[model samples]
Every structure is written in structure tokens, then in C-alpha cells.
Target: MKDKKQLFLSFLMIVVLALMLPMSALGAPGNDAPPDPAYAKWGRIAVQEVKAKYPEDKVVDYLHVGRKTNNQETIETFKLWLEGETKEFGVIIDIHFDTDTEKITNIQFKETSR
Candidate 1:
């Protein structure tokens, strides 16, 4: 009877201790793994433009060149490296959007031969 009571008390203490711990300590989301950074709207648009223009090539790497604002317009630039069967090239994509409407104004892709 004494052993049974001791076992019951031990189990109760463990439960209390567990409840006092933080939810993350119990293996909640983002505890052991971090979420990936999301792409901006302009970034997605630039990638799609590159894919459409260079269907024969695959994008190997990319770099976001940041955004520039001029009065009522904003431009997002990205440098994307593409690989083809026998050549590798870099493309500079400029995505221009309206600041007030958040709509695309123009997209230009310039290829840099390697």
C-alpha cells in the first residue's frame, strides 16, 4: 500500500512539472526548426519573368538588389544566374510598380553573358 501511494505521488509530481514547462519545451512549432523567409511580391514576379524569358535555362542562383522609390513609382531589382546546356549567364530583372496601386508598371530583363 505504501509503495502504491509513493508511485501515485511521483506520477502526480511529474505531471505538475510538465505543465509548468513552456509550450516550446514540449516540442511545439518553431522550437527546433525555424521558418523560412518569405519572398516579396516583386521577387515572385521577377522570378516568373525570368522563367518565361529563359525557358531553356534553369535559375541557379539569385540576389535581391533592393528596392528604389522615385516619387510615385517603385522598382525592385534582382540578379538571377541561369544555366543552360552549354552556357551560364546572369540576368538583371527590373520590376517597376506603382506605389499607390501596388500594380506592376513594367518588367525588363537584361542578360549578361558569362
Candidate 2:
């Protein structure tokens, strides 16, 4: 009985920790980007999509370029940017996008920089 209780307690503790872990921290961001050579297809598509949307802007850089598997679907998370112009475009800008259908889903931008 004692051994069983201790084992149960240990298992409970592990479960709690696992539950508490943040989903975002767990590779929601691609840990090994520019992913592998195999995922090149997705990479090009990602960049092209962003470029098409912001034709005048340049791809400053991108990170956290990957996705997660959820409920038989995949979620993509990444950041993209545009070269802001003070005179022509106004200011340099960067934005993020999250996609469920292998396209952009949520987006955020860099408002200011130090």
C-alpha cells in the first residue's frame, strides 16, 4: 500500500508539471529553423505569400518559423517584416502571423525599436 501510494503521488506530481508547462514554449516556435532541408517547400511558400501581400516591402528576417500539430490539423507560427521607409513608406515594420491551414492566422507587429 505504501509503495503504491508513493508511486501514485509521483505520477500525480509529474502530471501536474506537464499540465503547467506552457504550450507556446514547447516548440510552437520552430526550434530548428530554417527547418530541415525537407521542409523547404513550406519555407518558400511562406516567404512568397508574405512577399505577395507586401510587394513593396523587403523580408527583414523571420524566426519561430514552424508549426504545431493539433487535433488532426497543423498550426503554423512565424514572424515576417517589411523595410519601413521614413519618407516613402513612413517607418520600418515587422509583423508575425500564425496559420492553421498552413497560411497566416494571427499577426502582430513591431511598433518601436531601441
Candidate 3:
């Protein structure tokens, strides 16, 4: 009877450990957050434009600075870091679009040290 009880307890412990292993492998529950933001579209465009302009450079990082709105236009700003053959630099891109229709109006790029 003692051996049987010990074996059952060992099996139960093994089952509990197996379940816990899978949960840990799946990662934390908080990691299941929502998708990208509204500015993701403009961010992609900014990266693409920078890539086109600097074909010799590789885009190493990206950051969405912020957004601004006027009477009829909205500007989505992004900063992209590029690694060129010579050195690394950052480009600030402003994508101006029609607020209502979302049509692109203008895209401006400025190189910056910060």
C-alpha cells in the first residue's frame, strides 16, 4: 500500500510539472497584446522611402516620432537609423497626407545627428 501511494504521488507530480513546462514555453500572458498602431502604415512608407533614397545603406532601426495635424493635412513623422558603408546616420521623415481621404500629399526627409 505504501509503494502504491508513493507511485501515485510521483505520477501526480510529473503531470503537474509537464503542464507547467508548456505554459512557460508559451511565454507570459501579458505578451498577447494588441496589434500595431494606426501610424504603422506611414512608418512602413517612411522606411521604404529611406531605403529607396539610400540604396547603399541598410536600415538598422526605426522610430515613430509623433503626429501633427493642421486644418486639412496630417503629418506622420518617423526617424529611421541607417548603417551605410561609410557610417551610421538617422533620417527624419515626415509623411503629409489628407486628413479625410488619407491620400499622401508630400514626404519630406531630413538627416539628423540625434
Clashes of each: 0, 4, 0
List where candidate 3 sits over 4 angstroms from the true fold.
1-33
lDDT of 1 by residue, 1-114 (tens): 686467558767877786777555747655654344433667777888999999999886678988889999988889998878787789999988898998888988889974
lDDT of each: 0.80, 0.50, 0.87
Write one digit per residue (lDDT tens) for candidate 2, span 1-106: 6864675587678777867664535657654433366445555655676677667776654445565665644544455544544311212222223333445444
Model number with the top lDDT = 3
Listed in order, each prediction's TM-score against the native is 0.66, 0.41, 0.71
Candidate 3: residue 47 lDDT (0-100) = 90
Q: Write the per-residue lDDT of candidate 3 for residues 1-102, one digit (tens) a residue.
A: 686467558767877997898677668765654578999999989999999999999886788999999999999999998867677689999999999999
Poorest lDDT segment (10 consecutive residues) of candidate 2 = 87-96
Error of 2 at 30 (Å): 30
What's model 3's overall lDDT?
0.87
Least accurate 10 contiguous residues by lDDT in model 3: 25-34
Candidate closer to the true structure by TM-score (higher is better), 2 or 3: 3
Off by over 4 Å in 2: 1-39, 87-114
